[model samples]
Target chain A: MLVIVVFVLVGIVTALLWASLDAFGGNVEQTAGVYSTIIFFVLLVGTLVTPAVSGGAINGDRDAGTLATTQVTLATTGQIVLAKFLAAWTVALTFLAASLPAMLFTVLAGGVRLDTLAASLGVLVLELGVVAAVGVGLSGVIARPLFSVVTTYLVVAALSIGTLIAFTLGGLAVQTERTQTYIGIDFSVGGEFDPVTGLPEEIVCLEPETYSYPVPRFDLVWGILAANPYIVLADAAPTTFTSEGYPEDLFGQIALGVRSAQLPIVFDEVIDECGAALAGDPNSAYEFETPQEIFDRTVPSWFVGLAIHLVLAIAALAAAVARTRTPAGRLPTGSRVA
Target chain B: MTSTAAIAVEGVARSFGDVHAVRQADFEAASGQVTALIGPNGSGKTTLLLMLATLLQPDAGTIRIAGHDPVADPRAVRRVMGWMPDVLGSWAALTVRGALETTGRLYELGPADARTRANELIELVGLETLADQPARVLSRGQKQRLSLARALVHRPSVLLLDEPASGLDPAARVDLRVLVRRLAAEGCAVVVSSHVLAELDEMADTAVYLDHGATASAERIERSRATARDWRVRALDPAALAAALEAESIVTSGTDHLGALVTVSGEAEAAAVLERLVRAGIAVSAFGPAVGDLEHTYLDLARGEVAEQPVIDSTEAPR
Candidate 1:
């Protein structure tokens, strides 16, 4: 029943988004970008629902008095936990499967890159599995069903939103001072101004003025974003660039946010307008890097985040197995094996 | 056929934090007999059963179920042991047949064999009509029957039944008794723990009395059995029976609707009292101990324990 509701809701939302993008004369690539954004939204909803699906898998059985009966059977604790993990993962993946029609529609629209599609879906699937595994493991470890389910949600929230908050606060906490110099042409010194070009006929340079200001050192704390599931999804996907070197999709845009954080703040920047005019050059005072350039210069931390999540999942499952093993050495308070 | 113990525990002890659930439980149940684990409400019967079922670990001693150590090799014990817990719990969403089949599968039975076994167990437990219904809708007694069926899915040799008859009606209880006896006759060692002494008296071939988280020693149980207990002596004429009892020098404790109650030290003394009553021209219609064997022994042991230690153990109550 939940799967059906998710399917219908995703279908309606996808239809609305596609119609809006088409009405705005969005090209195939832009329409595909909107579709990816819709999928990301679906993934967010899936994360919330997956824990509910898997959170009570083990403890619910125990509360109902069925866990010990199964444990007394030939099945080992490892097999029981593994089976529950597999069952929960399958149930969670159903929501992803429900959105397949919309995904197919986006694919048929002719702008979705093959590598981008593979990478995004792959990460989304693995992330859902990780959440399910964590939920099942916690259900085994905790004695009560309600508390375990709530704990699963809290863990997911910590990864999805807590990491973003930590990264922002950490960057703000560490500040660095930067010195900048400014120089310009002095038109008053020239005999007559060139009206057509809005400049002096004879170039005259002004004195260089320098000033210092505090800048947030985001580069120092960019690694924190690697733990965020959304950031991991966005950053792991292969980003597409337009002719102007700007990202064309939401994945690239969010990915660009983390990549931009990696660039060090310019401490001794100089706006040498007077020197440029004297050298007979135009637009040499401002220097900026594109999203693609920033992406290239910085390291990809999505793999690191994924590895951390995998390790967490494995550790939780191992603890659960130890707790559920029988003849159990010690049980949690107010709990019975049979 | 060998005279080995089907279920054996030696100096077993278990505790939960400050409360010691089972201080020392030592007993052996051989094949082809029903052993009654007799104890009061808080005597740790269920705790001892859990340890034997391999669901719990003993803090101290060793347990062997079907010749395999439960702690060292629970799998081997589980393969030959069936436990019906006092608490009845079933999958709410699954039908009775479905639950049984699932249990069979968990025991490594094939699909076809599991289906066959489930059908057989449903019939044996007299739940044919409710086999297809979800277990949630079943009554307490019906759920108890389902729990029994699930435990017997693999036809285990050593059966542990804790409070198995608590919720059963008279007819169902009779059926359960017959079934349990039949299983024992088939060479299965059955351990039944219940608060109903009369029921155990009817079914149990042997009795193990536990008091204050400890099983009473054999010598202690024998001494308790030799303690003076009331015997009911029914007669056609109440006046004549009372007079005969007075003449026989047997002390009459009291009298109720059925007959007069006389205190007797042991079975031989009770027989002597009856012989004297009949010789004195009293029409004795019925003569037997006032309480069931298990109740008499259990109460005597409990009283002895309290008398031995005036400071009552508050932890003796059930959790």
Candidate 2:
């Protein structure tokens, strides 16, 4: 049922994007956008459903009085835990599989790159597994099924939305003052018309105006965004750039947000419009780095986030194994073996 | 020391934090015999069985099942030990046969063997009618039978049944008793813990009485067994029976709806009292101990009268 829901939702989103992009004259950018959107929805649904499926794996059995019966069998505690984790992982993956047709439709439209596809799908699968593992692990560690299921949801929420909130607040908490000096072009005093330069032949400059304002130091807190699962997926995918050096799709767009955060705020900036006008080029003063350049220069944080997630998953399962082992040394409060 | 003893516990103790669930439990159950773990509620009977089943570790002292220490080598013990917990839990999503088959596979049986074993257990437990139905549809008694069948999937040599007869119907209870006896007769060591002393009285060959997390010492058990208990006497005429009892100077404890209750010291005294009632020209219809043997001893022990009595010579006492 969950798989069917995933397929329908993903298919609808894909179809909507396809129709809209086609109306706007479909291209590689539209196809890439479609692919990224579908993958994102799949990840969202996968994380949301995994906790419900896996969160009661162990403690529920204990409550129902079946845990000890299995414990008495030849299967060890580790095997039982691992089996549950695997089962949950497989179940979670079926949600991904359900979105495959939509992803394939986008792929057939000719925009999603091979490396981007491989990396995003791989990370998405692993991320889903991480959630499943955490759910099963928490189930074993906690005494009650309801509490464990809720705890698993909280963990997912912490990783998904909490990181974003932290990044925003942390960046804002430490503000830096930035000074801007603007040298305006005195259009009233300039003499007429040089069509080639797109500026007046004689230009008069006004006194430079200086202003200081506070800017949030996002560079100091950008690492927090790296912990977010969506950001990890965005940052890890190989981004493609348009001919003018702009991001072509949603992944690059989100990746650009985090990557640009890595660049420190310039304390002083000068807008020399009058100087540029006098030098016969009016727009040269506003030439800035493109999104592609910023992306290329910033550090990739996806692997770090993925590693942290893996460690968290392993730790939860390990704790569960310790707690669920029979000939159990000690039991959680108010829990019974059988 | 019976070298053939399938279960041996020496000073076994276990506690849940401040609540000592089992303390200083000591007993041995030999193969080919049914040992009843007799106790009242909160008496640690289930806790002791958990230790023997390899699901719990003793806090102090040792437990050996089939010559293997459950604490040190639970796997070996589990290979031969089957436990039916007092809590009847089943895989609600699976059918009765599927649960048994899954349990057999968990015990390391191959797929074909598991299927065969599941079929045999379904028949043995008399759940053939409900074999294809999901466990969630089962009543408490049917679930109990499924749990028993699962425990027997691996053909364990030592069986530990905790309150196995609690939810059983009378006919099912008789089948369970017969099946348990047959298992013991086939050289399996069976330890049954239950609140139903009368059922145990009919099925158990010997009993280990536990009270307050401790097993009654053998000497204490003997003393309790020999303590004087009430006997019920029913005659054709209630007046004649009461007169005969008074005429014989037999102390009548009380009278119930059935007949007159007299306190008899032992089997010899009970027999003598019956003979006198018959000789008094009163047709005695019922003449027997008021309670089963295990119930009498259990009651005596529970009432703390076992320690006050000196050992009595009850050579002819019916066990």
Candidate 3:
């Protein structure tokens, strides 16, 4: 019942927020952006609530003196733990199911791509399952229900917030000194300058000036962000680009940020002011790739992150199964079997 | 112990860190008998039962529950063993019938079978009216009945009940006694542990006494039984009974309102005293041992141990 109330509340809030965006003249692409935000919020809330649902599943039974009764039955330890995992996963998915109405509202707003919908929803479901598995596993491994639940929440925080901090710190720690050369037109040599083109009449070449600065190498630590649940959700989604090479939705924007991190800092970058003045425009001299181009060049890390989460979930559950097996030898201190 | 016995345990010991819960337990209980596990507080009756129920592994021992080793093949033993824990815990959110049905499913019963079994058990435990009510609303005794019904869900051949009568009222306790006796009569081996000796006296046909984590040796038990013990003889006239007991050269210990106490060596002498009292023109209302058989033997063993080791706190000794 608590799960239902929480799910409904999140759904209603997402709906109202989406409706406000539409009323404020949200275009097709913006509508898609609003939908991605709603989906991301729903996934975030689902992940947070799933741990609470499953965290007390095993240890709570032990505290209530009900676990040993189940253990004594014909049901093996594997069956008991697996059944709990599946039940928790299903309960977590119900939160997603509750937001179906708002999701439909977003789709009706138009410009919702098929690949984006499928990939984001798939990743969201898998992430929720992973959280559920970890909660149930920790409940078995830890003797106290309260301690295990708190530990589960801590693990969630470490994945969601800790990964980001680590990634930032990691990138800043590994800096490379980049040397950039700037070639300028000798404005002092000419008396008259073109106001429209911002160039000297003679277009005389000045001595190349080299300046060095440190650049944070995010490429070295982007894998840390890969383990972040939010990053995995965003990066896994199929990003859509507009005609101007701008991201169409929140997923595309976030994915672009991760992709942009992959480009290496140019050590000997040369900016030719003389050549720019000789050409039609000075701004035309500097070349920068659009988000779409960077996204296209980079490799996707969502699968790697998803694979790591799945392995952790599996390992936790496997450890729980081993710890909870009956006819048990040594028991944890201050714990009873029944 | 014989393999055919329903429960055969030898040299079974389990410890939790420095505390030896069950140091050395040896006993065999046959099918169709309610064997009482008699012990004082913290004497490891529950620990031994846990081993038999396959919930804990013994540090050193061999345990066979219904001819299957609980450690080597816990599933085989669990299929035939039902354990009613001393602690009364029920799924608070589930209805009485729902809890029973869930327990049946855990025992591998089909949905329909589980429902049917649940209905039958609710009726058997006499909770038909409260079947739909959530378990949290149940009183202590009702919860006990539910626990018993749950343990019986699989129709196990071996039953282990720890402190089964602790919280039951008189009427419920009677019902529990009758139900356990009925189960035993159906050829299920039942082991009951309780501090209530009188209750076991009425229900159990055989008893195994545990003291300080050790089962009483057979020789020690024999010695305790052969030793002189008190018998209460109540008559229509207490004075007449006292005089009659005195006339027969019987040693009178004391007297209470209900009866006069006399020391007797064995059951034969007790019977002889009863006959002599009857011949003396005293109408005997009741003539029996002052305490139940299990309680008497248990107390005697406890006393003998204290006498042998005067320095150690008898209760704290880990046998």
Candidate 4:
């Protein structure tokens, strides 16, 4: 059943990519977009399917009466737990292997860089392994298979979507007031229009207008987004930029969103249109930074998120090993060892 | 502990929170002998077996399988002990052969040796016809056999079987008895726990009685053995048999369609009663103890009718 689900999801993504490639003639940027999109979807499907595949590995064996038999053998508790984790990880990797054709096609289209491919695939494999380890570990620690499976799903959901929700709510909960001042030029007083400057040679400025409103301080809570798996994947991949210093693919685009969030909102701003007109420099009133500049200026947080995930996986497995060691001293209430 | 004893348990007690599953179990099973662990429901037979199997630890007391502590050195104990739990569990996805082969491998057998051992066990347990079939397809009896075969994979010197004959047919039960005896004869110490006393009577050389998580003391077992028990006496003429028993001053407990039951003190009394019946010109058809030895002792212990006596030597009761 898991294999079928993986194949169907990969097939749908492949068909969608193929259709898009036909509609818009495939270019280097488009092919790169296709590869990034494929990797993202594959990661999505892998996380969704991994819990059901790996959960209930140990407790289910106990329920079926096979665990005690294995326990009585020469195999130690550590060996048994490690073997289950490895088996579940292998099963999860098979899902990644299922989408190999689509990934290969995108690579052949001449867009994906060698570094981007290596980093994304490596992180994808590790993320899948993390999920598998947690699932199998929870199975041994929890007494019932059903509860373990649900708990595994909750863990995955917490890392995938919970962080995003928390970041948004945290940012919204802390609001700040911002003031804006705007000075307008009076066209009624202009004598003659300058051909080069599109503004009157003589200008009369109106009274400066000032307004203030509350704004969400996203900069204060943007660190919470660093814990999200999607954010980690995006931030870890190498970004590609266009000639205009804009992101070209989905990874760069998502990374740009997170990187741009790091900048603090300007509370005081001034728009002196009359002053600029007086100086004959109408374009000098605005300041802009491209996505590429944001990407370069912000700190990358994928390694931190990956480290946190690795620690969680290891802690879960270690707890399971401690609980499962025998000769078992204390069994969970209402649980049978055999 | 005797040098020949492969399993020596002393004051073994295990509890699950509020429930004391095995309070004070003490017994020794010698190699080359079949020891029957006889008990009624909730007697902690399975708990004791688990401790011996090295799957559980005793809260107080020590268990030695082949002279190695199960709790402290389970690896050594496991290397010499094979346990078949009362609950039958198999790998549903694996074939019978595959399950056995995997068990052998888990015991640290080489790949080729594991395969050979699996085939040999399949034939030994009469599972040749279903050897290649998935374990999920097996009936309760077939699964029982597979579990037994898996236990024997490593050919340990000591074997622990919990309710081994529950789901077996009469023929299969007979085969099981023969196989168990053969294993014992091969110098393997076998401890079989079961409620089927008559079956154990024909197979086990000695019996251990457990009641309320404790083994019956030696004096208690001896007293139970000394109590008078019923003997079935059948003759060609029921009237003549009753008259002959009356003349011989033997009290008849009851009379059924098959025969008249008379309580006898021991084997000598039973023989005297039969001799007197024959001297009275009555033809005896069948005459023997109404229940197996283990059943009588078990019933006596369950009834709490054991006489208070001084502790005697801990020799086994007459089978």
Candidate 5:
């Protein structure tokens, strides 16, 4: 709850501060949109802290000498493991449930549709559950509470958000580029670049038919860019992100939700000679194509978030349960060590 | 023969890497009788108890609770057996009561039954006041009592106690002794292992003395009790009972050689011999029945000539 309040309140207050200072010519609506992005920050911090704090609960109990009493009795290992897993998973669920208001705030600002919100939350729950399970399994292997927590979190992060994330994005990159070529995105792009370099040294304007070295940043370019999937998904949520991807691409799409790495470029702006085109947008002259499929393809953010959270919670619970299922004599507790 | 040994352990053996914890050990705790498993520190008394409890499967030989095989059908054997380990190990947060209650619940007692058993055994072990305290707060004595309560909570007919007197003060030791006596009286087969030999002298009907992981000796419940040997004494001088016994003669020499200060090692029918002495005109001061002090006799028997130790070749089949 404290984490939720801190992140959400700061988002609102920072946006209000920007509006008050007239940072973007006193655009209140734009400031509201920026402030409402609090949902992302809440999940980001939650992902890191959840796995750190309660991840070592089973190992902690073993260290505390409680496991031995259970082991020597009629209590089987399964019962022991289930009990520990539930206790840790409950903490993760509590944090997610308590922070509901902040999630709603993003919806009110129109940045997240109801479906996107639900899907995002669903993914968050699953991802975080997997993290928790990984932590628990590591706890059994390590036998020390502190080491379990550190190693589980590191391993979970590496698998879920580290290397796998980069691979997922790179795969999504090929997927989106292929989809755009067939979906009339080629008409808007005007001439292809080297498939290897992808560093388009110069880009041609869609409306003016003029070639330029630096791409003019604009709302259309920022929202519809092929490189940043989150931006393309947000504007063309229900369609663009889904149209060209395989059925299994749902996994890559979910990973994209937790990744904030792509958003910087989406929000970065280049002062174009033509009254500062929107971030990464090439020009203002081209007619922006607003497809309804965009909103349709945007998987619900809440569901995505919920999935991540669920995965993490389940994984932690499973690992904890497995640890508990081990024979008392075999458990990591110092007692019955032989 | 005995009606049916409640616990029959025949040549049970267990080993760790290089250590022989239990070997060629044959022991039995008969129904409605208390058997004392007395041994030294590494004598394997507790290991034999564990086999009776079915907590350990023997590396060789067989053990049973009543007629149930302890190794092959442990669950059935378990229902009839209660085991109290030596160290209760409650130097943690959970209290004696909590540990006992949790243990009871694990055996699948109904909630109400578990609670009732927990409370009953708590009071039984004299830990009613400390029920809610964490285990870590308990003293060593309190922990052992709680562990005993936990073991007895299931009302098992066969109870295997590994050093039940451990961590107990003198008064508590006496109390525990009385409790074990009562349990045996109630027809529960009990095998109590203890380093304190004297406590088992009065409490145990049978004594199975273990030495170096094997049965050094097995004495019947009655024989182990050692009712004193009867003796007839006739002093040559009136009021000379002490001096006459101390005088260096065949009787005194025999007693001294056997480490017995007073020469009293024959059976009750020595009255005939006394009559012969009286007929010979020897003045008799007093003639009375004498019973051996088992504790003292045990100490003497333990000293040397262990050549008298019983050796049972080919232990009978378990159960």
Candidate 6:
């Protein structure tokens, strides 16, 4: 099943990559955005979906009633629990690995740097560990496999959907642009997010609509959820937050004719296009933003959230395995049968 | 200790909370033969079997399989003792081969060896056609057979079958008896617990009669003659045999296996005893000493027994 999931994931990403391949005009910035788009879907789909599938594995075996017989054997509770989680995680990773070559293209196109890829992989490993933990823990305590599966999935769903919805409603992000904003955008410090250039996204938008497009995990779009450090750092500087006309002094000539007339810049564009301002008066930018600055970038925000999820998942797995080892709950079998 | 003892229980006892299930139960099974443990329900046969399987520990007494203590050397005992529980917990979702393979692996069989053993067991249980079928779909008899196959897959030195034939039909039960006999022939000590008298009578070489959670009585039946009286009487006139019994010197007893009216000679000569019968104004009959039988005595003893003993906990039962 793990192998199957990998193939399916690969197929989907390959199809998406194949379809979009002819469309990328060799622009580094545009390619980075595409990279971000691909990873966004992978994490959401893999981390969220895999837990639900693996959550009920051991519980299902118990429900089928082989536990007592198996218990009498030399196999320990740890073996069974670990096997179930591994099977589930392996299947999910298959899908993640399937898209490896396709994801590599984003690097080739300069959508995201190799360090960003490495860091994102770290986040992925952590996310999977949490997913496997949810399945293992739920299966150990819950008798009904369906209940375990449903319950774990609901947990994953609540984390993914709930975080996005809550953060959006709380005004932490632009509400109108959902998963789409993450596409072809780089919110990371060095990412070119411009859709036309296919590179990591630069902080060029003061408002939601003018924000840098997704460049996979390299951009601040990932920070909207994961809390990556670079995204946190980028958001700390206020030069890109209020000075709308100051981004990229070189692109100012191009910015003049962006909207029609002298359009008022949004907060996103002010922060995004502040390179022009830095060239003129670097000190004129916003300073000492602190924690509030984190929300303005992608990596810091997304990683922080990702860390919380991973911690919760790992805790759940440890608890489940520990309980399975001792199974001291039934005080009635001895009393009745003896 | 009996030389043919397959499994022996010595001073075994177990208690759960305030209730005691077995107390001071002594048991033994002979090698290369079937020993039946017979008792009323709740007599702790299952508990004792489980203790022997190393699934539980008896609170007192020790269980030894071929001289090795189950509690002290469970790993070694586990490799040699096969247990078929009263209830078969079906690996319902797993195919027959898949489930057996898992157990084989746990028994430490190499992959190729496990497959080979699994195939042999599948055929032994006559499940070759259903080797890939899910356990959940099998009939009750088929499930029992599958469980039996699983227990025997390791070719253990001792086989503990707790009511292995309970749900089986008559024909299936016959097949079971044959299989068990074959196992015993291969030098395996087989301890089979059952409530069925006829089945045990046909299969067991020895009977451990469990009464009130202890070994109330035990008997080994080989080619030994019954201990009950056996008599041969020759009547000069078979029609007048009852009349001759009224004579003073000849004391009459009950009828013999040949349906003849039997009489005992009281130290008198054979002719004198016959003459005494003839003098009673009746026809004379010939008589001899009577031998004994065991089957009827065994049944009578079993009928007088009851259940009062507790089962030994898996942690403390004796070997």
Tell me, by DockQ, which candidate is best. 1
Clashes of each: 0, 0, 0, 0, 95, 127
For candidate 3, write residues A1-338 as lDDT tens digits: 86577667767776677667766674877678878988888877887788889999998998898888899999999999999899999999998888777787778878888888899999999999999999999999998888888999999999999998998999999999989898887889876787776676667889999999998989888888889888898899888888989888888888887788877677789998677867766676688788888988898899999999999999989988988998888887876677
lDDT of 4 by residue, B39-149 (tens): 877778888898899888899998888989999999999998999988899999999999999999999999999999999999999999999999999999999999999
After the best TM-score superposition of candidate 2, give how far the Cα of residue A290 lies from its true spot, in angstroms: 1.3
DockQ of each: 0.66, 0.47, 0.62, 0.48, 0.15, 0.15
Residues A182-262 of candidate 4 have per-residue lDDT tens digits of 888888777988887778778889899999999988899888878777778888899989999988788899888788878
Tell me the spans in candidate 5 whose CA falls farther than 4 Å from its real position: A1-69, A91-154, A157-338, B1-3, B47-54, B70-72, B90-100, B132-135, B217-319
lDDT of 4 at B90: 97
True contacts kept of each: 0.70, 0.75, 0.81, 0.76, 0.13, 0.21
- Ten contiguous residues with the weakest lDDT in model 5 chain B: B253-262
Model 1, position B87, has a per-residue lDDT of 77
Q: For candidate 3, give the lDDT.
A: 0.88
Measured by lDDT, the strongest candidate is: 2
Per-residue accuracy of model 1 over B149-256 as CA lDDT, tens digit each: 999999999999999999899999999999999999999999999989999999999999887688899999899888999999999999988777777778988999
lDDT of candidate 6 over A1-338, digit per residue (tens): 65466556755765675467647554544554456556555666676667667877766655554554565556665776777778888877766787677677666756465654666566665676677778778877665667777888877766656644543444434333322221122245655454664444444323333345422221223233343222221222121112333322111221121111112223332332244333443234434332223323312234456666667766766666655542222223322111
By DockQ, the candidates rank as 1, 3, 4, 2, 5, 6
- Which residues of candidate 6, in runs, are more than 4 Å off? A1-34, A37-40, A47-52, A71-77, A94-110, A142-338, B1-26, B39-44, B58-61, B66-73, B87-102, B132-138, B207-319
Give the range of the ten consecutive residues with the poorest summed lDDT in model 6 chain B. Answer: B221-230
* Pairs in steric clash, model 2: none
What level of docking quality does candidate 5 show?
Answer: incorrect
Give all TM-scores, in the order shown.
Answer: 0.96, 0.95, 0.94, 0.94, 0.59, 0.58
**At residue B311, what lDDT does model 3 achieve?**
27
Tens-digit lDDT string for candidate 5 (B11-126): 77876544566778887778789988876667677667756665556788877778888667666776777877774654365566666666778787887888888888888888
* Model 2: docking quality category: acceptable
Question: Once model 4 is optimally superposed onto the true structure by TM-score, how far is the C-alpha of residue A291 displaced, in angstroms?
Answer: 1.0
Q: Residue A90 deviation, candidate 3, in Å? A: 1.4
